[model samples]
Target: MSIPFDRAPTATTDTQLSFDSLGAPLHEVTFVIVDLETTGTSAGKSEITEIGAVKTRGGEVLGEFQSLVKPEESVISPFVARLTGITHAMVDDAPSIRSVLPSFLEFSLGSVLVAHNAPFDIGFLRSACERLDYHWPQPTVLDTVTLSRRVVGRDEVRNHKLSTLAAHFGTEVSPDHRALSDARATGELLHRLLERFGGYGITTLEDLAAVRQAGWAKRQAKSHLAKGVPAEPGVYMFLDGTRRVLYIGKSGNMARRVRGYFNASENRGRMAEMITAAQEVSCLPCAHALEAEVREIRLIGELAPPYNRRSKNPERNSWIVLSDEEYPRLSVVRSTTALEKSSAIPLGPFRSRKSAQAVKELLDTLYPVKRCTARVTAATLAAHRPCVSSQVGQCGGPCAGVTDRQTYLSGIADLFDAMGGDFSSLRRLCTQRMTRLASEARYETAAEVRDAMRSAMSTAARAESAQALRAVPEILAHSPGPDGGLDLAVIRHGKLAAASHVRGSRAVADSSAAIRATAEWVPAPGPFPADTDSLPEETRVLSQWLQTATLITEQGAWSLPRSGANFHAQESGTVRLGDAV
Candidate 1:
């Protein structure tokens, strides 16, 4: 007589099944071992070539189901056919996905779904379900791969592949890599794993279903985020499984940053750690820089992200200015408060103590201002000798304590003048010195003054370069043509350092606005020049063309090539050499 594959009848007698009676403590539990042969690796366009599943409960084999499905796409690859032994002719008469998916679903029901690398199988199943508009509520998914990893440890298991696992478990796997044979081997492997590692933690069907659904959702979300992220300004938030925010960050380009998280091979060490810990990702888009900044601050405050607390703290967003008194001393102060208190005075807001120190060092190098310790009075100064700064004439001999209050106050005033963004006074001083030297017929001294002036001007030029580069505007023009196009370049020291191809008129306008907004900013060192001659011939030629033909600027530069049509002088855009690229 043929064995029945249908569901067994439930007991009508009123006897409850206890955990012990159900064989809860036993090494073996029910599992529906599953495997699929597919046309390709990608689930998006690929179709299943074959399907196989075997149901077992309490270490007893119950039933088996297998079928070959005709894939909708034409031409199975030669390699795929060779590996699966399922040729194009064999599946030509087989049912389509619509006809076969229901049967597979029915067979997989009421048993834990077991597979090696469950993600691969589930991904394809989910994709197929989506395409067919079928609702295959996730079954309890038990990945022997994950179980083996846990039981054998990652380092000890050189190969945890299905065939490897079958071999390791001493099960002979015939027709390897094919769906039905692989499914049978997986069933045997599951039996050995349960025996070796104790019964799976799965209990209720609902419990298994919940775990499977959650895992599926996570995988789907990750895949969607990876493929669907937009390349635009936005803020991203990372959350744990409990939905508690872990980190928040803003990027001018969102897709690139999102992709960075999924780049396993390149960022394997870091990504491996992050992916295992990360539960979900959330993102928000911002239309502009100010909008993005505001949104970021508000979300950071609302979420109280653990990693962004430093930026959110009011105390950390402060500036410190050294007090100018008989004893000059460092004063801790808030940026907004200080800016409000002394609207006319110059102050520098620092993000950290290290930043503050760096600013102080820059001030000392540029201005050589006095920074004597507060404790040193005239009497104390007389007892000790002068410090190195005083000896070098960089300091006004504050250690000697001989200078009057007025003179010290005057020096402070000079420092304040320099810090107030007023270089005119320094220019006047150099001019006066040059005039005096010229009157004495000292051409050499005059030349030295000229060199000093160039040096000073270079600083201003560098500041302009920095400002231009920092706030690059959106491209205003986007078409590829001669008349309405803008050539952009990032110039350093009169040489083209970097170049970009921008065509949209709107992009040009946006980029111009961005550059203007950051015109006063200073450029940082190590900017890649677009017009460097060291590059390939074509790149070098392009760089030179952009540098000489296009308007160059310290901040950034742009120019629209002259269109052939009659262009009024006022209507025509003029090119300036000092614009940022």
Candidate 2:
């Protein structure tokens, strides 16, 4: 009787899954041992005089096929005839090469092929098939000579030739130049080589094919190192004996990804150095691919592993934060701490500080906002005269009371609107200024306007990316696990607040509990205008995941801003905000 249980499963190991799941057991693989006695060596010049084959599986012989085919040549070579002991009369009345091929191919249609040296036999077979308009069955082929070299080693065996290896392995059938005898010897040699392969953990045709290269065979023992890593989506770290991280990476399958580094075909220069230096591998399981990706970046920035070339420093981030003041002014700030406490509208997590500064400069020229930092009181505002910025018409002159508080605040309000993807006023002003400068032969001034316009649009795009995620109040999403189960995540207030695993029949209950646990939990808004490193680990991880999440509720869907990049295209005529008094 079979019993069903709902317990969560432990992680699957390398031995259980192996390199990849083999479609069938090795013993069940059908093998056709083939030997061809040709008139001479080269398939282009020589013709096959005899064909012999034995089909077997798991060391049991299933069938045999033998044929003597008449060559196009009138007589065989004296040396070949003597070596193979096949006279001309033996094949004189036999079927032709074309006629004999169909019967042999039909016998071995679905079998793996084994030969002393496969290329020599396959070449002759392929040549005949090509010449006669016959389709060659592309069977899985193995070369016993190559296998013998790996199995017995050059030190143990005199040579890899069929006759020499056959005697050494003590096969039941001895090798003679005759086709049938050589075929039987090869079949026995194949079984012995396969048994030796088992010692190296090669059981299937894929394993045999993989280990054919000396590089693969040399690293076979080290392949077990992959066994320690679990198969799941997460960040993997390679560390040296001193416990220092050599390299950090993320993948959908941590075990599979780590295993690939040790593969024979690995050709990266730094990868070789990392592999040799690394003594242990560490993994941190993530809720999903997005979390894994963010964690990878976070780790690189925090540790600054020498092998990592990207996202090494989170401190390099920049943001355009609207100031928390009576007369608000947009300023580029690198301090995440100042941003979060200022209660200002934070519009980035930009890649660089210069990019944030560009947008700040663009907004300042596009809108008539006060720039003087002196605390503004009705008494102080009336007594103070305008600064040079006011004289130049760069500001509305709020400090001099030339502009009323409500009037100046209205302009500041418009700046906030511009930051939220409405760039109609800014675009019009920038284009008009550019056209006027170009018309007056001030080409450099025109280029500056053009560049500022681009910076404004690019900044708008980055803000759009972040705001879209914030529109969703909360999300409960699940991603598929390696074992037909789900990895769950709970994002509250647009930040990944909690994550857990639920396998089998407990998905619904566990998912609800996970969301409820974080219901009252408000993740910190976190230090803004700073690099990825300054953000709380939970916020960084969740923010990345939410970027790609599918919001569940209609409230979440309809909450997003309807405007896009096209919203900026609404400004058609050139604007003269810069020249306006």
Candidate 3:
């Protein structure tokens, strides 16, 4: 659904589905009010003694389903006989549960199942389906007990228990611990609750589903915040009273998506907090889902909205940069701007600074690369002495003048080759080091070596993927739009430069031509292009889009590395491309 950006959607809104658009009106919905009398409380241990249901629509009775199910193993206790006026003798003549369950299921098919305490009755029915090997028609369920709690205040009804509600509502049929009587009472309660919900504009089955949600009143009251929000694919921002953004999200349907935040459909605890703090909902509608996603990523990165857990600080991500110096060394940096300043190749824009450091360590371990932080030059190298690392053979010690500049530089070249997806040397060295360490019983050090090796391999894989697209000077691609038609995008050097949405074959061609002509001029990217602004994420977004996109035009070779970052140990010290080992 990822499409180009900044274009007015050509697809008509009428065809787009939303929550309200799909719900069945309450009056049109058939509700099967059911009640079950069981020998015990637990569905696993209990046996249904009787099944009763009343199917109704628009307060009119459509049909009634009732059956007495004789228990196979257990008989009703004497206390239950006094409550329901039924016992083993009474159910002896009745059909067994296996014979009665199918008929009851058929009677309630295609209807929203309702019960006074739904879980108990529905659980028993579903459990019966499992035992009897009958396919349970997983119908929509409505619990009058939940509905009454939301509709009738505690002041009006002391408790939501069936007997309490039946008495409070003065039902024609009072619940008497019998299936038929309780079901008839529950049917009356359903209608009364529906009437109450109508006052709050809960006119459809979807609305009723939210009645059971905690903070139903608060959600209903805040529903107006969604007003005027366009029903289109877009990014939404929930702002607090001071107009500070509390949350940012994207959805195919902006209005419906935002509205859901104030409804039962959204149940995330942090979202509930965000909704409570939110005083206004604003949106930036897009042409399609992809544009929405891109905008969302960019916004989250730029704003770092507190509620958003991902992509908060694209700037905070760490990268392993090859330092631009007389004696080059690996260093961890926060921005890709270092790429523009130095002849350094960026290895990653890893989410964790620790992971980036791990890659640096892995590279240093495999190659006798410099580990010193001091800035050294040819002038300073003659005055320097061999460091501790040089004595231990971990570093080339170019600063000490012991290792010639050319020899140290040659080692760096091999290190760069490994970072550039040729992980053969790194794999072999780590494998040998790990085997040697385990033999010496240095298990923890071996584990550290393994982790560093993995971190390095992952960084290499990502760099390979990104560089493949960055090498392409230009690419024209199209994907199916959200509703209908095509989404055309012009990509330059792995960056989205222009995008448009159009309908019909003629319009697609026209838009494509216009987008290509008007596309922004982009210079060819440097090796290991930095993650400044949205470069890395945008490339990732484009890569995903191109995976399924139809290419109409291209410039330059857009080739990925042979194995692309799937580095694994292979025979003869060679590495195989697959998942990293």
Highest lDDT against the true fold, candidate: 3
Which prediction has more favorable TM-score, 1 or 2? 2
* Residues 1-581 of candidate 2: C-alpha lDDT, one tens digit per residue: 00011221112222122254434567989999999999888898889999999999989999999999899874697888888889888888999987899999999999888898899999999999998889877888888877777778778777788888888888888988888889989999998888888887667676676445454555555666666787767789889899999899999778767776664345466766777778888888665565576567667867889898877766666777777776776777778676775534565656678766766776787789766676667787667778777889999887777887688887667677666567667777887888888999999878877776766665455444444444455667665555665556655554444455556435546464645454334433333432211233334355445445443322255233446532453233222211100
lDDT, residue 131, model 3: 88
- TM-score for each predicted model, relative to the true structure: 0.34, 0.57, 0.84
Give the per-residue lDDT digits (tens) of candidate 1, residues 280-345: 777765432222343455456445676555345423533445554564534446544444444234
In candidate 3, where is summed lDDT lowest over 10 consecutive residues?
A: 572-581
lDDT of 3 by residue, 1-581 (tens): 12323443333222343344636789999989999998988999989999989999999999998888899987699888888887898899999998999888888889999998789999999999998889988899988878887778878977899888888878899888889888999999889888888887678888678665677667777888989988777799999998887888998788767767765677777877777788998888665677677778777877779999976776677877777777778888875467555444566768689888877877777788888877676676777777777878988887788787788888778677765566677777888999999999999999999887777666556556666787788998888876577777777777676766766456777677777787666677655344332356667787778878999889888775454454332332223432221
* Clash totals in order: 40, 1, 1
Number of clashes found in candidate 1: 40
Task: Supply the global lDDT for candidate 2.
Answer: 0.68
| Candidate 1: Cα lDDT at 339 | 43
